[model samples]
Target: MKTAMLEREGFAALVLRLRAEGISDLDLLTAVEQTPRSRFVAPHLAEHAYSSRTIPIECGAFMEGADLAVRLIERLRVKPGHRVLEVGTGSGFMTAVLGRLSERVVSIERYRTLVTDAQARLDSFGLRNVILRHGDGAGGLPGEGTFDRIIVTAAFPAMPRAFTEQLVHNGVLLAPIMIDEDRCIMVRLTRTGSRFEREDLFEVPYLPLTPRVAAFL
Candidate 1:
């Protein structure tokens, strides 16, 4: 893949475009501007990093475009003291964004290479509030305890009980549910006592959540 690096000026322009498109959250826009999307994508794909188009990363995973990332964080409404649990780290772009929006982030990725690389990229920016783990994202990281917000990057067949159990009361869980062969819908699942209230966010195609991480040689 032929990749092009986005220059600092280009990135700033991208941020401006996002703002023009009605992404009104100042914190979210600033986070998107400060974080370099190019660092998360392959060199050949770096040119598309800031564009609102999903790009391939290591481990055959896809990084959600900047637009989607912004939307997700805005809907999450992460507060400075909020603790976030991210089910899929992917390129760590989303995790990095979440780290800035919230007080702390615990991100889990099934791919070891992605876990290592994403952590390295995040560390390069000196972001210490984000924790990366190599494990099945379907099973929420329990040792870290309940979270104020949870975001699952991959599509799930349905809302998993494991994730619900790991969310704190009044917490939000955002994930895509597989609805058809070529269709998936993003749903916001909120935990209130023992009941989960579901709201459809939008529709997008995504890779399915797997039972286990693929063997990486």
Candidate 2:
């Protein structure tokens, strides 16, 4: 399918996909439709682009579980002018999505190769709002603390203190939390006063948030 077709037919289908997934934000859905997920994916996965299914891309990475990603970002309450931090810049897919929805996005990746590819791809797409960082995803970002939102794309074994401390009061953290032996659960965290509270959401598998998150703490 051509890029132009995504504007209309693609938008329609994306609306349905989000609706099926319970994404109620209309404007966010529009951004999702316009961003063109197909371009960021492997050429072979292009055909499955708008199906609400995450397909495997280059470098042994799978875009599986992106629909949950969209929902999580929306739940994060990102406004157009919000500054956000993203842990795990894999494929830069979610980073690009956040870039479109927010004014500034600082995304960190532990793997050098993923950082390089994500930077190149996002730059090619003209998403200048996203700043790519080469570092450990687990450490939380060094300078960009007090963000309006911090998104962790990979699942962490537990919530890192650095991550929770970095959030400003009322800032939301959306990430996958590992619950049991092999269960990866998605959760939304809202910082209140001196403490934070979590609301458990769904279940899915993702690359566990790397150990780098807690290296400094």
Candidate 1 Cα misplacement greater than 4 A, ranges:
1-13
Please give the range of 10 consecutive residues that has the lowest summed lDDT in model 2. 208-217
lDDT of each: 0.82, 0.76
- Which residues of candidate 2, in runs, are more than 4 Å off? 1-11, 212-217
lDDT by residue (1-217, candidate 1, tens digit) is: 2322355655666667767877677788788777878888887777777787888877777888777778788888788999999888888988998888889999888889888999999999899998898888777876778998998888888877888998899999998899986788889998899999999988875878886776871
lDDT of 1 at 111: 85
Instruction: Assess candidate 2 and give its TM-score to the true structure.
Output: 0.87
* Collision count of model 1: 2
On TM-score, the leading prediction is: 1
Q: Backbone clashes in each candidate structure, one number apiece?
A: 2, 4
**Model 2: lDDT of residue 21:** 71
Q: Model 1: how far is 71 from its true place, Å?
A: 1.2
